[model samples]
Target chain A: MADNETLDAKIEALTAEELARGLDIFRQKLGAAGALWLQTCVHCGLCAESCHYFLTDHEPQSIPAHKLEQVASAFRGRYTLVGRLAPALTGARPFDRDLVRAWVDAAFGRCSTCGRCSLNCTTGVNVPAVMRAARATLTEMGLIPADLQQVVTTALETGNNMAITREDWLDTVQWIEEETQGAVNDPAARIPVDKHGANILFTVNPREPKFFPLGMQASATVFYAAGEDWTVASEGWDLTNYGLFSGNNAEGGAIARNLLDSMDRLGCRTLVIGECGHGFASARWEAAEWLRERPGFRIISFLELMEDYFRQGRLKVDPSRLTDRVTLHDPCNTVRQGGISEPQRSILRRCVTDFVEMTPNRAENFCCGGGGGQLAMAQYRDRRLQAGGVKAEQIRATGARVVVAPCHNCIDQLMELNREYKLGVVIKTVAEIVADALVLPTITPPAGEDHDVTS
Target chain B: MGDAGLRLGVAICAVLAAVALLLQVVRTRSFGTRPPMAEAQGSALRGILYAFGPGMAPSAKESTRTHPVVYALGVGYHLGIFTAFGVLVWSMRDAAAGSALPPAPVRQVALVLTALGMIGGISLLVRRARGPLLRAISIPDDYLANLLTTAFIALAGLRLLAGSLERALLVGAMLLLLYIPLGKIRHCLFFFPARWNLGRHYGRRGTFPLRH
Candidate 1:
């Protein structure tokens, strides 16, 4: 990828003609459902409370309806009959640079695309879907926030968003494999890489190797305990997709295709996305649709796999290790939008001695304010922290010593919230907690042998 | 306009609305070209059913639960609009046959319901007008859509109750019918499908039948 300066120079060089191209791109991105949602909004303003931005900032623009209006107005001006005949009557505004910038700040900077507004919208307007179209519009013009565009560029040019080299990734795996062997006291315990024909080809958030390598080690340990045949590809190991966040489907497709190609070459039958919530949602639920390419293997979150292990007696955890009251923070992408809600809770029940539920959880939980590439967008740092106030308060109310979020992005935001709010809590991922509580069997099971330890 | 002119306007309005509705359907269908091909974890049918079912109840949504009065008014206003449409169609039939109004008791009930609907609609209009956030978000279509439907309900109520203002009621209803296809009021057609889409989108993902 071109360095940040080059990317910025490219974005700054965009012309009005190129920006107009954005509108055409938006027209392409706006699906039938999005059009219906755009027209369906009744301007009720009841969706305000559903947004963390609105709840925290209390700005009119923070309201999802008002935020949507910035894009919907442009859409109506260019497309709708009333807008064409009498723009004022429909409140349609002609697209301009100022309006486009406003849309960027509103759709990308402010909102997290948590889908909360759509859930509470009286008219079912699907605010996030409209906002995503706006993001695509801005992205087509090369007008994305610098950090976000940088991440997308890096992911496109390099294989991972963080641009971690092939040697570095292999080294991390080798290091984590050693740690797993030491902890399990078994030389056979391994964190395999580039093993073809493995049943599971696991992918991790680039942040895992970049910032939190311990979580990666924890995941490897759990897999080792379960005696699962899983391998992380040296290439295409980054599961986090900036393209999904930036609304650049081409980039998203390229990123997803790389993973599919990697899995195919490795002959993996199942792809397991490790503990990164949005990555799991993007790859498992969205990638194929975004790229219009179906993968040959079944894709599932590692949380689901961990839950299966508990049910099948493939892995056992002694919940007594977790003495602190624990709570699960539902990552919006994974829990609400991705349908992986129960699996995490089920895993937590077996991994923790005391697991408490956050009120208004599952699909209704407030976002950690790190979604939609908000964590990577440095421009919105303060706004992101303020938006996390709702989540911080939710955690305070739970009074849990440990907050287990399955998504790495949520863990990042929650950790900041713990510091800012002084909640005095420890944040950990489900895999991390599960790995801690795992009780390895005395006898190592034979390879390819299926044994029910409990049943 | 007199009865003949109003009836002619209503005919024209009906044709325009049909065309507008057809165009919208076609445009939306084009966007709906791609069907979901992902491996289903749960039933979209069940999720859609739930979305339109209990999912729509006031208790099901946070916005509705916290703002009961607003939700109630909105629901009541829509019910009134549906009831008024039935009355308009039935009245149009009577006008064609050169007959009088329905029985006095039925007219009285219609008058009460239409009045209630009018109250609900006016309340919503007032809320929009007063709240700065709402006013900021609203378009001219928002006010016009509310005014047309509210006026239709009010005129219908007056005609049914007083047994007078027949021409005014017919004209108001005709204007509303004409504007429905052109304005935000067309949500009457789009709302159910939008809800169903949410249900299917979230339901197939097993996000619906919301887990605790």
Candidate 2:
């Protein structure tokens, strides 16, 4: 008991220095757009209902505006004269251990950084940006949950969050390649690795090779059907970055640089991100910002590539086989933030005979409660599950037998929701659905040639 | 006659408010000027238009649609505040030239609008105080700002109803005008730029002009 008290005293003593540094980091984050958001909020509380956390728990602390105050109030104390001189007048409070702990939980655990509340903000305050500043500050103070820190550390050390070895990755890929060939009844099918000058350099959620190898197989089958030349890199194949989740810019930049270097080495034309929403959205769009350089080649999601194939009439799929009513859960990162909403719907429309949309679908869809690294942070699992109830109800209302989410995280969470809620639905990625209904053309491509379509 | 002092006080307060607001604008702009590193996927012009245009439509937002009455009241309150500002300028112009008040018809219209705004503003305050979430999120500045603005609007309406209250109204307006930079009410100055940046950010991401 004395040792525990001593440890607590040490932690409490560290707060003052940590807070001063955290304030500096947060102040640095407060660029013009961020400052405007911080200053413009009126505390109108309209965003309370817009937050899934508040919706589920009805806790005022779950209010998006209050979560923002955690960051903005600190800024107020440090930057504003009124806050400096008369802190109470402006609701500014000095940082302490309790404040830091509260902010870490509210900013990282309770919230999904889903960008939902911002859509309804009357003054158009960017709630997610403010939340991100809080996360970044907490990260600077080394207050990130152990689970999130482990993911970031593993990614930095092992080039993937799951720490899967090259031998394991290769074995899984080769086995899936064989399985895909047998499933398609075409011995020529392959999941090419390290092929030079391939049209597409594909990256998948590490979860794919680690646990869900069939998901990668489905994606490869679609590429094979389209007769497209694609290769996965032996190095830097993990496209997902926990940095975005952890609010560590350096880690995110490193992840982007690694992928760009890999793409350059392989001489691939397009970087195709796989069926993971946040990873696809972050790497394809946001990573460039962290790296601050244009990645010479185009970045495209697998959904977009499939949509292109469908538009070009290259890959034929028999939708009659997918007769169950299917509903799509738009991943917040991919659809709302990434702007890849239409392509998934377009793919699903052709890939499924019966396709329905969840109410308030598209960019406005509720999160699957697994985003913002919630799935990785075990401490927040109960809160995540409760927040997911909003999405569960939306799916239940659709009465769809199959739920098609193009995001791997959403798929994982929805699978859990299905079991918990007894929704009696199967969860599938867009690629998996396409793979299930793919119709192989009569004329096949040679084993090692770029696709040449004349249709 | 002695209203010149009141009119001069309002002018001085307005000038101070404008100067403070300008410094804030400069500080905010200086930080936000870093160009976005991401490639633009959609037209920023379209996004700005959507942000100010249809985006402001109550139907375009869930909060607005869910609480249409509160949204309408809030909109009405802002309209009243803007209208009061116009009255302040008009009354000041008349005092400067030592001219007569505007035709009673215009005064009546102004009076009705300012009264409506006061009602909206006061009801919003009551609502904020009553709700658990609102009370938790609100700071002292929120209540003070709303109360001051609502009181100013009420004073303006009373002055329009009876010209004898002009001095009180001007004093009330001056207090709000001076306090704008120090409190939450200053959202008036930042609201447009905030929305513009929002439009640009969302617009660049192809998330703006939010398609159904």
Choose the strongest candidate by TM-score: 2
Mind giving the per-residue lDDT tens digits that candidate 1 earns over A8-58?
Answer: 555566677776777788888888888888888888999989999989988
Model 1 gets an lDDT of 0.84
**Root-mean-square deviation of each candidate, in angstroms?**
4.1, 3.8
Q: After superposition, how far is residue A165 of candidate 2 from its true place, in Å?
A: 1.0
Give TM per candidate: 0.94, 0.95
Question: Which is the leading candidate under lDDT?
Answer: 2
Error of 2 at A258 (Å): 1.7
Q: Identify the runs in model 1 with alpha carbons over 4 angstroms from their true place.
A: A1-16, A443-455, B1-5, B30-32, B96-99
Q: Cα lDDT of model 2 overall?
A: 0.85
lDDT score for residue A172 of model 1:
81
